[model samples]
Target chain A: MTDLNNQPQQPQKEQPGDQPKKSELVEKIQQLGQSNVAQAPDSNIHVLPIIGQVEGHMQLPPQNKTTKYEHLIPQLVAIEQNPKIEGLIVLLNTVGGDVEAGLAISEMIASLSKPTASIVLGGGHSIGVPIAVSTNHSFITETATMTIHPIRMTGLVIGVPQTFEYMDKMQDRVVNFVTQHSNIDEDKFKELMFAKGNLTRDIGTNVVGQDAVDYGLIDAVGGVKEAMEKLNEEIDKRKPDEDEQVIQ
Target chain B: MVLYTPLSEVDIFPADQTAYDSTVITTYNQTPVKAFKLENGSYQIVQVLSTDPSIYLHPDYQPGMQFNA
Candidate 1:
């Protein structure tokens, strides 16, 4: 790499007579062949995309596309401490995974002092619902969908009364989180979760775009443009308060 | 321990591992990206995992563009 750097300089110096008319544009064109694109200042609103399956404590098989919680947890911490970042945008397109991990992420986003927004694209199913609502404001693209469903254990189960009780307790956590963060009430959300005939052989409603907003699950039925505008507005709203604190 | 998803268990956990090994998450010019390993030992950009929206607009960083390993 250092040799390549020297090579470019060497050509300019040695062929100064022959290439005297080699314009800066020509130089740029030559450099463009390489991977050296000039960079701009970092964005104040950092994006955290929750794509594919949200993998938690158990590592999904290698072939499965996963958004690892370990990577995200640290990133969230960095976002909190980074003075350069003023806002967060959680871009969600996930078929939700572990309950605990999803809740952990949702909690983290909800607690962040900086302005935060989430945009649900494709499908923000199951646990993704909580995460989508966790932000200060949320958006869902017109074609996007959100699956509201009850939690279920996949591995071996004892199949006892206590097991059902335990599952209900876990379900309550997700229910509580989504309802608390968004505008949907518990009864309505449960109705959607347990609704039948919507999904073939499944018991959930796949709420699309405007339906999500109508149910009060998401703030609006818009995409990136609206999300950016809302985030900037919230950022501006908090800026004055932060300046006051700095003065104090 | 509970899975809260509309997707089946099989879809979430695939049987094959080789398919996943072909791609890796790495940093290019300070921006983190997921790239596919080419047969010639170089990697091709599959996704740019950066917060800077501008990074996505750069022609050089677009998907299918190759960079040296």
Candidate 2:
């Protein structure tokens, strides 16, 4: 078996004109620890990572890692426009940032024609909750946690009462999005958001893997393997419709 | 100014804006990437910002790879 595998690679390496190519291949294997397999230029399943902080209007400092809306919005538009891209898998590991930005991303993902599956790996806190549930299906690892919290603002507050109402509206938007997208209801979600003892000195609940599923916040408890399986299944389900359209 | 996050505002926002000016977003092989300009005038990849899954598979496009042109 080993000899047969080696036989096909021998000629390509020994050809006089192929010397430069051979060295490049060797370097690639040495550096990446694997030979680069010939894959189609377009990918049917594209992964969009919602990692670090979801940056919005403010430009975060260079030291901080963030997922900028400008980059993601255009990429998402491209993914939707590209016929080759059939499925989207959103990988979430975000601490959450601006409310509007996070919601904008969630809305875009929710509106995509292609099937999507989101897997919350680490902590998908605050605004990430909406984005996580915005997909066709969502997953969370056994250790992953989702923090359900109310919207808050820091720094100076000129009108405390009006600010509270504005924050309430913002919080309602997130709640409405999550409740509409996922299996969780408004009452239960609000309960989780206002739960007192779950987080010390904080007014929200940090829901762990299975608990999130129990609360109907996430679809299931799983990682990449399960998320990919779900995505492939959804993609396959959509294939027939596309084929029917082609036939017509 | 209205940051909604579980993390402290101080930890999220830096006091100095000049520190962020060193990096720039440019295209490498038709893919958008965030890179830093080295002293030698070459760019080093900081992040591969492409939605194409195959782009990430390329060894040269990986983070920290010295991208020429």
Candidate 3:
């Protein structure tokens, strides 16, 4: 320590209270630099966008846009544990990349204790179907479409009878997850998964907004207005239960 | 430039107005009014308020039936 703080102790004035504002400015600037994703803590609602493709254990090439599983899992934990965060809004616009990675995200969203909602915009293709149905309520914009198809993988594969069985088991995991969380029937979901001729040379059905609702895959055909309103309502509904717990 | 519905009438400017040439209005009240920079001085509505949590297409438009898989 400097002997008796030999520095000049000239002016004695209350420290200005502007430090918080200065830090806030820095935070604002940092937020501005981020792309697509943002969080508005004031409303206690965090917005998470699953865009491009969901990247798995192997990181995708720099050219490919991906939502990494590792990043999102910890984020989901924060949203659940955060006292200020009252709800979650998942915005999905993915071509559906890695099956395991997408399923991990879906499981996290489905398990959140707070009010959760999802709105599929554009194309929530492939594994995105499971994610779209992971929330308590799901919305699909009129223009958005979700493709339901069996799971497929890239890279080398072993040519054994067990390989086919392993693939079938993986497909079942996805199917069960979707049907269990969503209102869609098992048969209906399977039908969509295996349907042919929908996509040129691909086997699956392209389900649009209202059709998604009709098939019980999504809860409503609406936009931000509806999704936010419904989520707010759910948050309000949860308040009393929290109070009841406090009383006990 | 078209400042879409309801938000067009809002006279209040967002704090981020100075950052971008264009104003991003959103339909969701909780979602902040985000702004984007434009090449020219005049700001356009790059983001619709309701579309802040959007993916795929912009809020106002939807892709055709032949969507990329």
Q: Residues A1-248, candidate 3, lDDT per residue (tens digit)?
A: 01112433436444676576566456544543322233332346778889898888764443456777776787788778878778889999999988899999999999999999999999899989999899999999999999888887655578899999999999999999999998999999999888889888989899999999999999999988899999999988877676567885
Clashing pairs in 2: none
- lDDT order, best first, reads 2, 1, 3
Better of 1 and 3 by DockQ: 1
Chain B superposition TM-score per model? 0.79, 0.74, 0.19
Q: TM-scores for all candidates?
A: 0.75, 0.82, 0.65
Candidate 3: RMSD over Cα atoms? 15.6
Report lDDT per candidate: 0.83, 0.85, 0.72
Best by DockQ: 2
Q: Give Cα distance to truth, residue A21, candidate 1, Å.
A: 16
lDDT of 1 by residue, A23-54 (tens): 54464455445444655544788889999999
Error of 1 at B65 (Å): 4.9
Q: Which candidate model has the greater TM-score, 1 or 2?
A: 2
Q: What share of the true interface contacts does each candidate keep?
A: 0.24, 0.38, 0.02
* lDDT for A147 (candidate 3): 88
- By DockQ rank, best first, the candidates go 2, 1, 3
Pitting candidate 2 against candidate 3, the one with the higher DockQ is 2
